[model samples]
Target: MSPLFPALAARSARPALRFGDQALSHAELATAAGALAARIAGAPRVAVWATPTLGTAVGVVAALLAGVPVVPVNPKTGERELTHIVTDSSPALVLAERGAELPPILAELARLDTDITGSTEVAEATDTVDRALPAEPSPESPALIVYTSGTTGPPKGVVLPRRAVAATLDALEDAWRWTEDDVLVHALPLFHVHGLILGILGPLRRGGSVRHLGRFSTDGVARELSSGATMLFGVPTMYHRIAEALADDPELAKALTGARLLVSGSAALPVHDHERIGAATGRRVIERYGMTETLMNTSVRADGEPRAGTVGVPLAGVGLRLVDEAGAEITAYDGDTVGEIQVRGPNLFTEYLNRPDATEAAFDDGWFRTGDMAIRDPDGYVRIVGRKATDLIKSGGYKIGAGEIENVLLEHPGVREAAVTGEPDEDLGERIVAWVVPVRADAPPSAEELAAHVAAQLASHKRPRTVRYLQALPRNDMGKIMKRALHD
Candidate 1:
């Protein structure tokens, strides 16, 4: 209901953000954003070179303040992906960090560079501070046109409105008991929902502060948590590293134990890593569930148990229900019954920018089809089994989830990382295939040993019929296992 950044206007020298060595107080951010917003006020849309820098944060805030739709382009994007997004979005202007070398891919669009230092610092004493900030934009007006990672096709632009972003942040505020006093820290990339919306805007809306690690490391996490940060946000890769370090690093354990909340998302936090972190720190890592199409639909509540392997109940104001394979709504929560997760609420994206067919297909009635399969427990906690497209394996007429089997394999001391998929088979409809990165590459665990370990923990049918070893599993920037890449 309130403006997304009510904290920026009235400031008293409180620190607002930190990235590597760069820092900005609330007053400084308002001044800088005000200046940038004024320069880009009339543009229909803008593209942000979403680097892990203060300029990126200032540029995004400025665009939002100016009521312009922002298309965040990842800096590490490939040639084809870069060309497609730049062509599709067709922004009136591009905002990037000053003096930073950009691929000639962006040579066409008009560009604006943010000056975060001597040449570009926004000062509270600026003449524009008293200038009337534009009237707040309508809630339904498009705020961001974030493009998906062209997994299925060329990336489709997801049109998220002001209402959706604001509502999701407010719901998280209630769920996490988030407030101005809480200072958050994370090292996630800024292009997506987890980092840009919740990691950045969520705290800004609550009038709190955030410190970005620029790049993630156990040492960086330890330093920030020990300094003043109250919360730490990371993906499973980050946590996996933390879990490994805690076995030898007392400082890392102490820092985690002293923090208020440690959260993981983007992919399922392996139950093994979850238990290890909890056992050492006496604090369980909270998990949440959502997608690019939806900002955040559910999270483990701060007051609730950090249930290992489960993303806790639906976020406030979200209507969540699972549907069976027959397309019937799953009403009662009988444990272990798998279904596709569907959600309806203000937190949903409005459309796939320009693609009416996709917009039409993404929704049934008002609910968005997440394509994610999960089982709901009696108390409303949702444990995601895996994605319907890749992580669900059908073997010998029985449906199987790769997540649980991968978790089982991870429990083995020899396995450092694991991913499971289904491949064509003659006798069985599809056979489970396990791809592993082993701790001991010279003497990797054998198929038989891994099979027996899985069978002891789960049904024998769920064991991988075939095993593959790799030096490392391919992962995206978000730490999600690129299951499709595993095939190649």
Candidate 2:
């Protein structure tokens, strides 16, 4: 297999990474990471304390260069979850920035601080180290062990292989028409697949540059895009914020209008936000779909129609199928039948670490079972409705997707944010419920008005049977609604 980053050895002086005020040229990054890679060359595995900093990126790249499996540990992880991840992965050492205080759970492990500025004087030593490094780990070798949110129980470690990473990014290079000329910008956290692998590594693989906003702000996004950044990668929450500010900030609108591409993922982008942004900037925000277990499954192609509600066709080399509850494949793509998304491809993770039973149950034949529920249009676009575990509601013999209802609710002028889930109901087997954060809390939209709004947009059976108000929906760092927290 070819080197993961074929261009790193070019030693160009072009800017490769920029985080806030700190920037590293391609030559500088190669020297720094290569030197560090030599130090930690033969470790069992390494844990990277993933912070939105230059050190985090340097550490991860260094690990990859060393052919060591790197586990990214969220800096905000609570003690219990951190303990679980450390125990499960059993890394030989932790890689972090100097002076970043670690939690007690990680006290036992040795720490290696990553330096983003390795002087060019060390170029010879770095080259010697790279030359002496073992043969590049095979494509099937483990690269990352990312932990899930543990919503169901303990967060399971998703073991992503190098082959999956290379395949997904190369496919994206095809789908996005991405090239080294593009300068990507984002403020997403570095712990997950979306931000860490796609947002960071994708650019590196193409020998492109990335400028990360230390924190997300409309002004920062506008500055980057207006100055030179060609692309933007964000979750739905960031787009929603962009939509909200576009009407008031002319600079923001101008920057967005000038951007070559805007991509959203990690959660569904409400159709209302999509239209709002499009109307202001005349740029359609493309959405992609993926998970911790699968790096990326689908994306709205750069050259194709930017359909607001759909995550475009299965990526190149990926096989996608919808399965019914009876385990039969649903071949009809009439745009209304919801089914569990099952995918088989190089994009899929090798296994859930240390969970053989789960690894076995996660696949049917060869397809990985994605708990996401989605419908397909005749044109091959896929619209995710919700998760089968929480969003698929059976009411009065009709199978309903909560995402459709939530999207409709978001369209209401009075609703600011929305989440839909199912509750046990004796008569309907399950009842649809809407959790809303209103635009005006003092005079919130009445439950009756919201319910009627949803009924008018979708079918009456899909309307929420109950509405609950909140100041804001419970969300994680990635801005995904914590539905399990709603139960509490």
Give a tens-digit lDDT track for model 1, residues 268-297. 999899999999999999999988888899
User: Pick by lDDT: which candidate is best?
Assistant: 2
- Regions more than 4 Å wrong, model 1: 120-125
List TM-score per model, in order. 0.97, 0.97
Cα distance off (Å), candidate 1, residue 124: 10
> Would you give me the overall lDDT of model 1?
0.89
Please write out the lDDT profile of model 2 over residues 1-488, one tens digit for every residue: 98787667676677889998888877677778887787889998999999999999989988998899999999999988898999999999999887788898776799887645443324445546344333568999999999999989999999999999999999999999999989999999999998999989999988999999979999999999999999999999899999989889999999999999999999999999999999999999999999898889999999999999889999999999999999899999899999999999999999999999999999999989999999999988999999999888889999888888888999999999999998999998988889999999999999889888988888788888889999999999999999988978
Give candidate 1's error at residue 193 in angstroms: 1.0
RMSD per prediction, one decimal? 1.5, 1.8
Clashes of each: 0, 0
Give each model's whole-structure lDDT.
0.89, 0.90
